[model samples]
Target: MRVKKGPLVVIGDTLLDIDVEGSAERIAPDAPVPVVDVEGEHLRPGGAGLAALLTARDGADVVLVTALADDPQGRTLRSLLNGHLEVVRMPLHGTTVCKTRVRARGQTLVRIDTGDGRALARVTDTVRAAVRRAGAVLVSDYGRGVAGTVLELLGEVRAPIVWDPHPRGSMPVRGCALVTPSELEARRLCPPPYTSPDLAARHLTKALHAQAVAVTLGSHGAAFAHAGGHHSRIPPPTLASGHDVCGAGDRFAGASALALRDGLPVEDAVAVGVGEASRFVEGGGAAAIRLQSHEMGDRPRTPMEVAELVRASGGRLIATGGCFDLLHAGHVSLLRRARALGDALIVCVNSDASAKRLKGPGRPVVGQRDRVEVLRALACVDAVMVFEEDTPAQVIERLRPHVWVKGGDYAGRELAEAESLRRIGAETVVLASVPGRSTTGLIAAVQET
Candidate 1:
């Protein structure tokens, strides 16, 4: 947790995204197309708007600077973004762009595109000031003229910039902190024939004069290249398939910019972006983003919800399980160390019946509820959940944490949850327990006294 006071500014083009979902049970006799029985309509901000919204969802103060026409579609886009972001409007030369996707059974049937909106050549003083004062800036160019409009300002800004390039868009400004291009877009920019994304990133970094280039490889993660000739691949936690990837690029670019703002190294920032993009697609992508869901600013979330949010933001989620009968230094130490291993820590405590069964009669000096409360009070623990089973296998399945932790006592032996973890593609680690600290030892000492 790096926290920056300056707002994250997103500069790009905004589009209205409409997802029409329903069941397609029959094929039309006239055109041989599936006839979708309309159920409901979902509207959200698209392109740069989506990037800004994602940043805001991750608890950043986001300012979106984009062009919006005076058309009905533009108004809809603004309305959708009103409470989620601070909009700095630029002039648009045409109607607002709208992409309508008709889907059935989670599969897109057809896409209908409307409008040809592009930002005007003129730049505003407000946009200039916003860019200059930004803690971090994400240029989510959708090839809609906004990037070209602010190319000069972007070059002059001292704040770190993460440029999300488009095949049809303007080239990134010189001196960008990081440039993000999808594998397909990288091929379009540097041409194929070039072997791997690593080479593509290296060539683009030098060609664009950027500090670093991250070529996003979709579900495979990203290939990172620095101007100094160092390269590495950032791998996502899981490579599960059949996920919605509509807004994954925006999630990656937006998260990278925020991480850089928090003073993370370029490599770490790209890793954060990769993790966040993976989680975003896994959570149903942009289609799941509802305006009402984002209104909760700092409200408390459940353990599973915390896990989802952490994953969605490209942050790691770690889980530890135990009876936690009595709140002691040992428990605190294990939790704190576990938290330091990832972005958020989820404590899975055994239920009262389960604890009694595991520890025998007269055990669990503290009740399960009290133990849960104590764990939740710790700053190291992000959330706490109780499991009825003796082991946390079921809980782990639901949480799907990236890392599972246990006391050092389990170091030599294989954990019972190992198979469950393998199913979810998670890893397990055992931390060294305090030599003289234990709930059982404390109980024995009290009995002797």
Candidate 2:
């Protein structure tokens, strides 16, 4: 939770990225194919969905409105989402936007892209509504189906729109809040290629009539052209001298969106983006999010384990910890569903002393250690650890979990940290539908006899 301001809605296409690794040996024996042995396959989220996920981690209330199919790949996509945001998955259109890459070490030599290029007709309406509701909108153009309807959406939605321009796309996005294009991609989108990032940003700004323009210069850094008719270059973080770039743009966009939505000045936002992007490429995505809630077995986990869980879960994690002194079906069902939402579930059970203090005289029929152990034994619980406080707010802040899940009769305000949660980089989901169960009610009923 890094002080986010408003909601971000993205209109774009979903993508599935695949990476191939191996050594390039001699030529093939039969024909001309290179003798490349298969090592392993890596799958990651892509396109606009990826952009949205990144924004969400930056502490924005993000919603991804896109179209994907119901096939296994689509299931994989939805599973990746894991209820992190609101998704509009289209059944008719195939979801996979596959990009096959051949990378030996630092550089990529070849890539084969695949996926359903068909744009759905009905998704536009949903996107339009979402766009109208957002504080800012970023249309990611991957030459995917996001732009067809977005073309129409530009005229209708009044929110500030940011454009992530790409090559070979028929995008008519002008008069946006900001248009961020990589130097290579900028050349493809813009007619001219200026010698410097400043010139490029200014030129694009004057050309597009947009308030701000940014051109990413890979190794050198990023430059911004502001509406005030001035330009500034934000340098990328040079860690230990050399540079190792990986998903830097995603980090930049995430931090930038959060800052802009929060009313930070252009220069300030760009600086923030640069800082976060540095952490991203430097420490990897897990550390960049700054989540404190991550558990393993019955013991509290180290920062490394938490980072691993975040990475393994693609940063999509649902976190909730409490003392269920009574232990009922209500708690069971909520925990079960929360576990299903993401790759892992981290539960923080209150310590005995804290629970006793909160519950008061003769309370917490079960000790905190025993209570945590019980939760650890459950199949749905991924990790069970102890917390000293009455609430899991401290743990939540450290973990900065994407989703804050709770089980009880609470909804909206009654649950916890209702308003402040989003700004701090987490969304709240209330689980109250379970029937005929309540710890206080059960206690009262037993005492009446």
Candidate 3:
């Protein structure tokens, strides 16, 4: 079916994915295993849940049809997904699936999978109606039986269907608009000697009697074979290296469904999918999906408190430190630019004593409290911090912002707090000052007048 005006429907199983990330420095005395000093925990939706979230974030009116147990993990998933998109919950027979990845230094040390949940073989009239009215359907099957229960209904739907298959999942029904399988999954589905993705795509397309089969080849992009005797390979615009690829496949499938719904040809839709997946990986993969609240409370947050909230939600924390004595237009421009560099920006203003030490005795035309208040009034600044040290080294070390910005020309030279940034694996950014605007010059002009 080719309904093109209804909301996108994502159907399958949902999972709770947790990433416990930290630093691993030394091996334990008992065993050779590295001792990980846990830094933070990031919890987000996985499987079909993630696909629906991605589609919703792309400005689509999306609905998620999936199975969830009445458990703690299930409640958390519902809480996270409910306000974001409409969820048509189905019956689940067992516990909720929870996958925890223990990682260090941007690498996964180990993955622990739990739960034995499976969707009950019961399809409601509501699910059937949703599939019928969908502009497009994305089946993100995690092999938990949700796809199996609605397989027949999906085959009868008029809307474009994009099936993202798992190796353990059931074979796609006949006449799907697109079936996306990873290279390994395709190889597993096909017989021996069908090693090439092109061969696997063609074989699966013919055997499954589908409109097209797209075999995802990870960083190499995807290869597809259509039922109309057309086949080709689409390479990514740029290969992303050393980035997490946790949900790239789901992203590709979700985007492809949207593209097809917008009337793009299968080949072109697959190309779009490849580009989106590449960009997703380059943007920190699934970890960059910020599901947590960034709301500021009535009380002003400390640098450490702001950093903790941002990091826990998988958002970038940016910091800029200066005296901010006069709060001139140049300072405002610099603060706005720094804020644009990340998800949240926190300014570190020098304390009264610290500013006096650097700007001389008669300096700081504005007091530290008023300067902070003025800076806080700017819409670009998310939070403000006052540091007692001459340099913001101590505060920087504590907050450990992902980016540290300074307003000056110190491109090649190391900043005064460079060592502190290095210790936290943070980058330093140098922004040029606005010409003919400086606090020192302003005071001089006032004296002359």
Candidate 4:
């Protein structure tokens, strides 16, 4: 039950991103081409669909208006967004837009795009009504024709608008709240050899007659220019190397719209947007999209799945086990340190039965599902699994993690998981816990009050 304050309306074109990952070990005999032995594939919502999904995931109630053809890809897109959003799909006259990328090992080999690029159907009364009722509006234009109709429809709405513009898309009207463009797009908007991001932002703001413009500068962060004659640069949060940056701009736009809809000032909203985008990239970006399925409810991973993931990562796996019924600063600090020791951190949470058995009756103030969600929200926790046993010995044996981490409470004391760790040939590490931060103590103080 945490709900955002109001509904956000998003208008633009939706696309399907298909990634085919395989091994390209041999070249074709007839032609000079690498023959890829297909292994796996992934499909994700892209374009404005991705922006709407990101906004909903940020806790906002979203109404997404877009066009979709009556095709297999369109059906897949609808299925993917079934429960996540209130999608108002217009009947498109052409084929659904699809971006198919073929990757070998980890590198992209080739990409093929399929679309008719036909003009979108005109906006309907329903879309206009939704826009009128929105607390805020976001236009995620991907240079697709859908944005053209959407921009025309939004001309009459007075709500704050966050336009993520494309060079070929419809230009935003005057007095809009914000416009965001990547550095490359910014340069195109204001003409080339642009001296600095600040100048580009200022120029775009004035040309679009918008209140502000935020130009995203990849790893360096974002530059902002407001109509009030103020300009500033917002740095991104530190992120690990080698993370996939796909969908980061969508996340930034969605987060900024959410903050602004909730009444945060422009500067603060831009900061929140930058932070959200950085976290999204740091947490795996496109690679993490599959994990969103588990957010609806806790789908505790089996030991086999966890092992497969660890193997796929080709990195050391670090694991820790605890009730984690109530997350606090101590838990965050410990998890952060544990993640630093390896490429991924897997948290083994105690099941409800196990928590009740260990902590006596009236324990686990938070339910198992809620606890898993809380733990999953942490950037340091890459995966979560629930163990029914009082101790995580079974899980440890199954996972055979590279390192087993414990908090300061277990320092200098014999650990119940020691035998399991030894059997699995996993090294054990004890991290110092934050002072005066214990769930038990917190519960006691609450009861006393």
Candidate 4: the clashing residue pairs are none
RMSD list, candidates in order:
10.1, 11.8, 11.5, 7.6
**Candidate achieving the largest lDDT:** 1
Kindly list the per-residue Cα lDDT of model 1 for residues 12-128, writing each as its tens digit.
Answer: 999999988789999999998899998667788999999997777555778999999999999988888876669999999989999999988778889999999889998889998
lDDT of 1 at 58: 56
Q: Tell me the whole-model lDDT of each prediction, alpha carbons only.
A: 0.84, 0.64, 0.83, 0.80
**Candidate 2: global Cα-lDDT?**
0.64
- Compared with the true structure, model 1 gives a TM-score of 0.68
Tens digit of lDDT per residue, candidate 4, span 1-449? 33434578888888998878789989999999999998667677998898887766544679998888888988899988877779987777788889988988667789899977444567788877788888898889887777787666678877789999888888886788999999989888887678989999988888989899999987788999999899999998655543568788998998888778878888788888897777666555654455222211332345456556666656467899999977876787678657645556789999999999999898898989999989887765778889999999999998889889888688679888889999989988775565457889889878888
From the highest TM-score down, the ranking of the candidates is 4, 3, 1, 2
Where is the poorest 10-residue window by lDDT in model 1? 290-299
Q: How many residue pairs clash in each candidate?
A: 1, 8, 3, 0
Q: What is the per-residue lDDT of model 2 for residues 89-161, given as tens digits with 9 covering 90 to 100? A: 5433544667767655424557888666556656446665677777777777666666665586676766667
- Arranged by lDDT with the best first, the candidates are 1, 3, 4, 2
Off by over 4 Å in 3: 1-4, 239-242, 293-315, 318-449
lDDT by residue for model 3 over 117-207, one digit each (tens)? 9999999999888888888899999999999999888768888889898878878888899999998888888989876999899999998
If scored against the real structure, what TM-score would every candidate get?
Answer: 0.68, 0.62, 0.70, 0.73
Clashes of 3: 3
